[model samples]
Target: MEMIKIENITKTYKMGLIDVHALNDVSFTIKKNEFVSIMGPSGSGKSTLMNIIGCLDTPTSGKYFLDDISVEAMGDNDLAKIRNKKIGFVFQTFNLLPRTDALKNVELPLIYSGVSSKERHRKAKELLTNVGLGDRINHNPSELSGGQRQRVAIARALVNDPAIILADEPTGNLDSKAGEEIMEIFSELHKKGATIILVTHERYVAEFADRIIHLFDGKIVSDENVPKNNREK
Candidate 1:
C-alpha cells in the first residue's frame, strides 16, 4: 500500500524580493511498512521536504496524498488531526519537557487525543518498558543520559501507535555506541512492521533504511534500494 504519495511537489519561500525554491517538482512514494531514508547536504531542501512530509508545512504547488487522503487541501485543523493520529515524530534534540518524567512525556500525545488517564499511563509505561526504560520512567530529561533520553523520546513517539514514524537526525546527539543502540531499536521497530521515514546526513545512519532517497538543490538526485550485501548485519 502506498502510505505516502507525492507528485510534482514544489515549495517556494519569499525572502524580500527573491523567491527561494526550497523544493522544485519533487515526487516520490513510500509504501506501507517500508523503511526509507532521506539524505542531503545543507541547503539541499531536506528540512523543507521533511516538514512537508510531516504535514508541518504545505507545498506551494502540487499534490500530496497520505494514506490516499489529499493533504494539499487540508486546513490547519485537519493537518493537526493527521499529525496527532497518523504521524509520530522523533527529533535529535529529544524534545521531552524538562519538568516531566519519562512516562509523562510519553503520555503527551495520548493526552492530546483525550485518552483516559489510566489508559495513558498504561500505554506509556508499556512503551517505556519496550524501549528498555522501565526503571527510568520516573526520570526527568535532565536526569537521564543522552541515550536514555532519546530512548524515552522514541517510546513517546510510539505511544500513540501512529501510522508513520518520522525521525529527524534521531541519533545525531549521541556517542557512537549510543547512536548504534538507537539505530538498533529503530531496526527492531522496522521489523515489527513500522513505516519509518528517517532523515539524516550520515551515510551509516541513512544506510539503516532499506532504501535511500538523495536530494540535491531541491531535487531528487537518486533513489535506490540498499544492496543486501552492503547492509550491516
Candidate 2:
C-alpha cells in the first residue's frame, strides 16, 4: 500500500562557487490514501523534498520509487509523462490562467492527454460540479473569490484523475474562513479515497493531515500520526 518510497535522497544546488545541500539522506514512505503534511522552517529542504516527490526535479543522489516505479532511472521525457499522468499539483498562488474560464482551466490537462473535445467537456464539467463550481463554469479566475479560485484549481488538479494530490501551501493566500473551506474540500477528497500530500509551514494547516513529517536541515526530524479525535480540531 506504499505509494511513495524515498531512500537516502539528496539534492544539491550550486550558486556561483558555493554549493548548498538542500536534502541529505532523507528516507520515507507514504501509504496510499494517506493525507500527510511536510513541514519545516525556511531553507529546511521541505520544498526540495516536495519537488522530488512530485517529480518536478530529480535528486542528486539516492532512489525514489513512486507507486513502485523507479523515479531515479527515468529520463526527462518519461518523468514529464509520468508527472502529467500521475501527479496533480495545487499551488498557493492558485495558478490559473487569468483569461481562461473554470471549465477551460480544468480541461487543459485533458487536452494535453489528447482527449476529444466532447469527452473533455463532459469530464471538465463533471469535475467542476463535484468541486461545487458548476454554476461558475464560465467564470474567469478574476471573477471568483479566493476560495472559489482555489476550488477551480482543485478541480483542475483532479481533472486527470491523478493518483495523488500535491498541494503546496494551498491556503496561504486565503483568509481564515476561506482556508477552512479549502480544508473542508480536502477532507471530502480524503473521504472519497484520494491520497494527499501537502507542504506547509503553519501548524494549524498541517493539523489537517493524518500524519505530519517535519524536515530540518534536509532530514526528517519527526514523522507522527495524528490521533483520530484531533483530526478536525
Find the candidate with the highest TM-score and give its number.
Answer: 1
lDDT of 2 by residue, 1-233 (tens): 99999999999999899989999999999999999999999899988888888899999999999989999878898988878888999999999999999999999988888899999999999999998998999999999999999999999999998888999999999999999899899999999999999999998989999999999998899999988778856
Per-candidate clash tally: 0, 0
Candidate 2 residue 124 C-alpha distance from true site, Å: 0.8
Candidate 1 lDDT over 1-233, as tens digits, reads 99999999999999999999999999999999999999999999999999999999999999999988899879999999889888999999989999899999999999999999999999999999999999999999999999999999999889888989999999999999999999999999999999999999999999999999999999999999998777766
Give me the runs in candidate 1 sitting further than 4 Å from their true place. none
Off by over 4 Å in 2: none
Once model 1 is optimally superposed onto the true structure by TM-score, how far is the C-alpha of residue 191 displaced, in angstroms? 0.4
For each candidate in the order shown, give its overall lDDT on alpha carbons: 0.94, 0.93
